[model samples]
Target: EAGVVQSPRYKIIEKKQPVAFWCNPISGHNTLYWYLQNLGQGPELLIRYENEEAVDDSQLPKDRFSAERLKGVDSTLKIQPAELGDSAVYLCASSLRTSVAGELFFGEGSRLTVL
Candidate 1:
């Protein structure tokens, strides 16, 4: 089986611009996750979807960010009017199921640079 796949490994935009990222999780994986990582810090969960349902998204900044996992296969994350502080690495991951210690396979990530 293949691992998660993400497009546009990197992106650069000026503040107040919009950007989007795409991800394709492994087949048969029912759980998908998006994470944001800042320099020198651990990755923080942005949103988690079980199939087409977004089960957890408290950490996601809804004001300027949005995500959708259409049909529970491919997903897209978008940020509008991005701010300078929004620069970070956006990661996509997936697993067969959710568990306290379940292993996750992560993609190379989409690095965003807000100028």
Candidate 2:
């Protein structure tokens, strides 16, 4: 099966501008997730999708961030009016199930820098 794919591997934007990132999960996987990882820290879940349903998104900053998993195959994460604190690695991961211990395969991530 193909691995998760992400684009732009890096980005730089001014604070208050809008930025978007993309992800494509592994084939045949039913669970997908978006995570934010700051330097020297572990990845924190931003949103999760079980197929097309967004199962968990409590960690997402709804005021400036939004996401969608249309058709349950691919996903997009958008940050509008970006803030300096939003500069981090936006990683996309996928798994076969929603189990807490399920292993998530991660993409290289889109690294964002907000100036």
Candidate 3:
């Protein structure tokens, strides 16, 4: 079985430009998550989806950032008029089952650089 998949592994753009990242989670995995990691910082949860419902998105910036899960399978994250502070790695992860000791599978990630 395939792990999560993310597109545009790397992206470089000038400030104020628009950028979008995509993710395809593992099949039959009802839980999907999008995380952002800045340099020297741990991944912070941007959003979490249980099926088609966005269960958690407290950290997501609605002003210039948006995300969606289609049919609870694939997902997309977009940032418009990106700022220099927006440079980070967008990670997608999925888990078939969650337990105290279980692990989550992560994609290669989308690394964005705002110049």
Candidate 4:
């Protein structure tokens, strides 16, 4: 089965610019997540979706960040008017279920660098 897919792999932008990243989850998976991993840190959940519903997004920065999983298959995360502090790896992961114990499969991620 195909694993999660992300594009650009890397991006460099000046502060205040808008940026977007995409993700395609594994086929047959019902749970998808967007996570942020700062250098030397573990991935922190940004948002999670069960099919088309966003089940968890408390960690997302509402003022500047947003995400969506449209049609229950693919997802996109956007950071508008980016800040230098937003530089990090945006990882996309998927699982078969929404349980906490569910194992997640991750993509290479879109690495963003804010200048």
Model 3: per-residue lDDT, tens digit, 1-115? 8889999999999999999999999898888899999989999999988888888899999999999997889999999989999999999998765434256789999999999
Residue-level lDDT tens digits of model 2 in 20-92: 9999999998999999999999999999999999999999999999999989999999999999999999999
Better of 1 and 3 by lDDT: 1
Backbone clashes, each candidate: 0, 0, 0, 0
TM-score between model 4 and native: 0.97
Per-residue lDDT tens digits for candidate 4, residues 38-94, read 999999999999999998899999999999887999999999999999999999999
Q: Please estimate how well model 3 matches the true structure, expressed as its whole-model Cα lDDT.
A: 0.91
Q: What is the C-alpha lDDT of each candidate?
A: 0.95, 0.95, 0.91, 0.95
Model 2 Cα shift for residue 94 (angstroms): 0.1
Ranking 2 against 3 by TM-score, winner:
2
TM-score of candidate 2 against the unseen true structure: 0.96
- TM-score per prediction, in order, is 0.96, 0.96, 0.93, 0.97
